[model samples]
Target: MKNVSLGLALFTLVACSPVSQKNKGKKYFADLLKDVDKIQLKFFNHGDTLAESITDQTEIDIYKELITGKRDPKQKIKCDSTGEILFLSKKDVILHAWFSSRATGSKYDKACVTYSVEPESYGSALTVRSGQDIDDYYYKLRSTANRMAQH
Candidate 1:
């Protein structure tokens, strides 16, 4: 009788254990997707001065402010030729993109802008194209990138 009771207790304990589905690639931004339409992308252009002002450290500062709404004066980010900022979530979701000069004769030549966000689960890429008017697609990409970076 004692052995049967022990076996039953052990089985109950094992059966009641909580299973973890947090392996990897679990959707973190599931809720954020629904509110994507509400995002706004504000464009700022200081021409070459703005572009040149964005050093490694400054770029990180701007990125942090844009993404997390927190500014760290000391966090140094090494900027490359592309002037891109990359922020990765603990769960491995990537907010990877770059902004560059859109040539000399373009409408918005020296404006800094992000191009896209590539998620690990989704195979198709999301891109924000250059346009004269600020559109919903650009805002959605920007907001998604910001949320992903914060995560």
Candidate 2:
């Protein structure tokens, strides 16, 4: 009986030790935000043109419309007095500008503009490794950041 109880307790510990699904999702967003913050810091530190980094003309055009208020049907983004824009993506991804209103002298500030790039189709979500998801998330985050910075 003692051995059985001890084994059960050990099993419970191991099972609960893993990260919860909800926390995993939060971490995904947090990591994505961190990557964006790094990119913005690098750009500002180097005084580089954010637009030059983007190779997609469609994305560039979309960004232009977003800033100019010619496109963006949702109109979820807004620019503050400091030229910072807040953009929220359809996938619940939130972005704040480098000098956006939400940034409080922190390096990891919210993006100025945020948006999502859904893969060309509307399909069921797929489950994959954390590493793989994180890489993809960073790429998308960077693209959004570049778009907002350019405009």
Candidate 3:
């Protein structure tokens, strides 16, 4: 019967489609942090200048945990960046984390950070707002950078 044939064809098409394969699970921003030995935290002074890189493993680990631990998925993608953390392995930058400034909060501000695998290609990457537990880390880093810049 045509009905049976059509049903079989549809089933085959659905099973072989790329969407079906890609839908195994949702990929989060934290997925890109794997195997990164050194994470360089570069604080931005109002998007004008970048402070010195923080390479200490202890500090880097703290930031890594704070950033990847909790995430509030954000639908809105755009934000004013205040700082970024580069996830590196063997001296090669693997991922870039662009975080919003505390001073530039809007009505919808929930403390967001965008993670990009490629440089300057955040439009297709994952952007997540921080949960209550990890919200102030961005501001804290910026303050630390400001103090460093003064010296």
Worst 10 residues of 1 by lDDT: 118-127
Check candidate 3 and list the clashing pairs. none
Among all candidates shown, the one with the greatest lDDT: 3
TM-score for candidate 1, please give it.
0.22
List candidate 1 stretches off by more than 4 Å: 1-59, 67-83, 89-93, 102-108, 117-151
How well is each residue in 1-151 modelled by candidate 3, as lDDT tens digits?
9999999999989888765444322244446555567866555554645444546665555545544423234645455565566778778887776655444343235445665432223422222322322334545656777687799
Residue-level lDDT tens digits of model 1 in 17-129: 53322211224333222122122222233332111111233333333333321223353322222234344343232453443334312244343433333312211111233
Reference-based lDDT, residue 57, model 1: 39
* Local lDDT at 110 for model 1: 40
TM-score of each: 0.22, 0.22, 0.49
What RMSD does each model have against the real structure? Answer: 16.0, 17.2, 6.8
Query: For residues 1-151, could you state the per-residue lDDT of candidate 2 as single tens digits?
Result: 9999999999988887563431334344344443221111112212332222332344323333322112234634343222222333333424433232222122322234323322111111111232232234344555787787799
> Model 2, 78: alpha-carbon shift in Å?
25
Please estimate how well model 1 matches the true structure, expressed as its whole-model Cα lDDT: 0.34
Model 1, residue 145: C-alpha shift (Å): 31
